[model samples]
Target: MINKGANDLGGFLRSRRERLTPDAAGIEPGVTRRRVPGLRREELAELAGVSVGYYTRLEQGVSTSASDAVIDALAAALRLDPAEHEHLRILATPRRPTRPRARRSKLRPSVRDLLAAIPGSPAIVIDHRADVLAWNRLGHALLAGHVDFDAPDSRVRPNIARMLFLDPHHRALYRDWHAKAQVTVAALHQAVARHPADPGLEHLVGRLAVDSPEFARMWARRPVRTCSSYLRELAHPVVGRVTLVNETVTLPDDDQQIGLFYARPGTTDADALILLAQSFERRLAPGTPSRKEEAR
Candidate 1:
């Protein structure tokens, strides 16, 4: 598995450069037929104002470091977005992570209180490794009422990435599973790059690479993203259907985030959220079997 660091820089650069054609990059195509789809290595090196030998060394992972000016020129040549540019820098010159616990990270009580305060909304807190640290009652009901609400507090906590790829119950929640799966993989790439020393994160990637062919394929593609908000459509078993505006509030100090989902006001979708709250109130009991378990 490709854990994000100096190792994947070459692959990531190759992937990005392969997607840009000669015409798109303002390079003239000569009479010679090209073997590759996009800009040739020498052409890209010329565009970025670097020598062919040096650029070749960089792309082949022989040269692990690059100056800021070189990174800027390469980012410009590749037409990388802000996120991709950040990712390139991280891979090219990785900073030692200040906090590398390599174990289960904890949630602050204040964050849990905030989730509880938003009773009608579906709110959850997840750490950098995508472990579900905590979720309010409505959040639990809206996403995974089939599982115990307190599962996050257990020794074996719920992991969002694992659920998305490995759990059939969680997969059924998404109306457009592939889209979310893509985002999840990209987000994981960002996380892995930022915290390369985190063993839990490494193990998560390793396990998914082994278990899910689809995830393995996506992982190999080297997508990099950092998410702040998302628009998602869910075919919830209880709610039937609802479109949620998911906003992520990052806690940089703790490497955790609070995810809040809201529907537009005065719509049927708004009413459905209330129904989820009520359903949770009706059936959520300590040690009681979840709806999925009862079905079994």
Candidate 2:
């Protein structure tokens, strides 16, 4: 088996180097001999304030304990964006001294209650790996009408990012698939940085890269984006067209995140959302009692 632990560091360094050109780094390419487009090893070393031999060792995965300052210099030398800079820190940091605790998989009852109380808004809580831990009825209807809300922990549960890239339903739901795809990839890139040792996350990324050519291509570009707040234009099958402002808030006590979706106060989209909620309620009425009754 490939030592993915070391390969990740080496792969990232090689990719960053190949992405830059000698001219871009203000280094003249010698007419005599040149094998690569980017700055040579010596040039990158000089720019990053390290010896050529030391830089080579780092790239070859021989040296893994680089200081934050050194990694920052390397990032600056590579012309990394915010996302890439963060990734470099993650990759260069030494392995944890102690094994990390297994992430808690269950959502707190209080959090579920909060989601249920948001009657008009659609909201969900996701774990660090972007697994859907829980969602309100409206959230289930808005994001994955075809998925089973009662079985969130099931393997069949929908992943927002995975659906965006692999599922045809998501492709049709978002008006601008390219834009949504970029954000999804960027968010995944950030998540990878935060949890580099997570085997489950690694497997998911590998599967997506292998299965979707589009995902593979975008992953190579190494775009980094954080989606704290954004507007989503959703083409709901029942609601037709609606624009919702999405916000992601971190839970105070855990690594869970809550995503909330809201429409403007007095717009046609808001009306459509109300109609969609009503339709969703009707659909669920036969299977279970009213949401209020369930709470009681």
Question: CA shift at 126, candidate 2, in angstroms?
Answer: 1.3
lDDT of 2 by residue, 1-296 (tens): 12354235666777788888988888876777888767778889998999999889888878876899899899999998886787788878777654544544677888988998998999988877667888888888888888776657565556777787788876788876788889877767666666666676676678888888998888876676655888888888888888889899988577779999998878898888788789998997788664544653
Residue-level error in angstroms, candidate 1, position 290: 13
Error of 1 at 68 (Å): 1.1
Candidate 2: C-alpha lDDT:
0.78
Residue 65 CA displacement from its true place in model 1, Å? 1.6
What TM-score does model 2 achieve against the real structure?
0.86
Tens-digit lDDT track of model 1 for 28-102: 779988999888998899999999899888888888779889999999999999999999998788465476665
Taken over the whole model, the C-alpha lDDT of each candidate is 0.84, 0.78
C-alpha positional error of residue 44 in candidate 2 after TM-score superposition, expressed in Å: 1.6
lDDT of 1 at 115: 85
Off by over 4 Å in 2: 1-7, 29-34, 97-104, 289-296
Cα error, candidate 2, residue 34 (Å): 4.8
